[model samples]
Target chain A: MFDTLAAMLDWFGIVVFTVTGALVASRKQMDAVGFVLLGTVTGIGGGSVRDMLLGRLPVFWVAEPAYLLTCVCVAFAAFFLAHIPASRYRALLWLDAVGMALFAVAGAERALLSGTAPSVAVAMGVITATFGGMIRDVLGGETPVILRREIYATAALVGAALFVLLSLAGASREAGLTAGFL
Target chain B: MFDTLAAMLDWFGIVVFTVTGALVASRKQMDAVGFVLLGTVTGIGGGSVRDMLLGRLPVFWVAEPAYLLTCVCVAFAAFFLAHIPASRYRALLWLDAVGMALFAVAGAERALLSGTAPSVAVAMGVITATFGGMIRDVLGGETPVILRREIYATAALVGAALFVLLSLAGASREAGLTAGFL
Candidate 1:
């Protein structure tokens, strides 16, 4: 029913990931190239891996170069805006959680549609939700947040599992999506 | 002219890369899971990305699951044998160079076969030869060899460039392959 809104949220997820990637590069005092590289990779790495794993050809960003362009711009701008307010930083954190959860459900859905086992679909969800950030941190020479923390991937796990279970129970996909977000 | 030999060399390249990855993970003191993860990804990451970008479906490893099994075995064994003699380590380093050169030429050849421009083919070559190690270091929280030194990717770049130039000059594909390793 809210396809446009869902699309907007998905776009926000990419932006949020890009911003975080750029911010992390700033923290590392990396050069402009570094900032852009980290940002673009963080924004798209997880989904790209997921698509590749599922044999989705050309991956998403290759099929849609605009996503790559948007990530570059967002990252370049972030280099200058690194001193943004702490309040906005807090807001970003909140949005990032929403983004990761959304990604988890989305990844599982894709895997299920591709006919993988439920267990593997759940793994796909966690990988989609957290891998981009993990890669960003790795490139920035830091330990990945996924390995350091409990909550990040656990939340994605819960969402992915619930989505699969709900789908199995013959619930509408829309309802499962709502449950994941909640 | 020596297709069988070339294929064998290619296989050796994968094994060498896997060993290097596992060794790096061992040096990082990562667990067994980490060793396997690093080794497998390092062995396959570059080519997988190349395929995805070129829209090659199902990826090579998924089509040949034996590659995955071999990587896992090699990585696990490396965990126990990490303390091997420095001479062996030196041997592996030399093998790695051969592997990288072989991969660079192989990658360019693949891209060229797919009808990409010579320039893009060369880029594909370097990406194929180096991105796996780059990902391995990033995952290990070490600065990537590609970023820290001038030589790592320069070697790949040279090999890739040579391969493309020779191919364009109407030399034998075999000539280009020879040049890459030389």
Candidate 2:
């Protein structure tokens, strides 16, 4: 089912973001607790914000403990692997891009399911894709990379909007999502 | 009416927090944009997070533009007044405490109105009281005062819990709110 696929993608995105958060924390020489906190927030912050704005109760992570466990485990893994070559950051960036793409589609799809207008759905997608990273950067005392360079937010916005338009044009849900993800 | 009184308190709290935010920006010698952004975030962050978690749409400032306007104006004013004596930080701290008290009560009341469990309402109150400052500190690259020392979050939590208990004991809403505020 599409819901199952979506959930898988969501989990994948959370793991990717969590690792990125842990990487950042390790670079800052933060303690284990700091790594876990950063990783957890970065993994869940965006979707949590979106759910809150939608008046959804029992935030997604709170409702599902699996996500929390995954983040914690990933944080610990990343912490121990912090000495991996600097090239790991390049991999992190690519993973972040994939995560952002999936999260954007997921956010837009959720907003549409909630009966929001198309524009709102698109906006929600951008928020979901970007907020986690922003929060991570802020908490780590770095200016958010999204605001500096790169078309990060722009890519998410376009992807979400494209998905919405494709859906409106009667494309299959999977097709629309795939197109957006690409 | 109770609504009017609540609105007044909310506005007062926003202004106080905004000023505190701008003061932080000034202390850091940030640019004008920094001042406004910090001020606005510190003024609205807690309530916005609370609303998002509660599934409240559009957030409060989005529904009421006046709060946004007030924050912008106050931020600019505070930026210019940054040269005021060093004693201003102390005054700002006290004002922040008052804002925290008011916001904590308001947050708890709103959560109760939304039918959240009493403990959840108290948590929301603490979040609404502290999150804005945390965001400001994080973005400004300063450690959040709430995490360092002081009874900041504890005070908010206690106030919210007291309000809930008083209300459960059949106190008038105003009396419960006043008790929490004090």
The DockQ figures for the candidates are: 0.18, 0.15
Cα lDDT tens digits, model 2, B1-182, are: 76776677778888888988998888888988888999999999888988877777678899999889999999988888877857766876787788898888888888787777676676677678878888888777786654342365557767888988897888988899899988
Model 2, which residues run further than 4 Å from truth? B1-48, B55-130, B138-182
Q: Estimate each model's TM-score.
A: 0.62, 0.61
Q: What are the runs in model 1 whose C-alpha is more than 4 Å off?
A: A1-45, A52-109, A115-130, A139-141, A145-182, B1-7, B87-95
lDDT of 2: 0.81
What TM-score does chain A of model 1 get?
0.87
Candidate 1: what lDDT? 0.76
Q: If chain B of candidate 1 is superposed on the true chain B, what is its TM-score?
A: 0.89
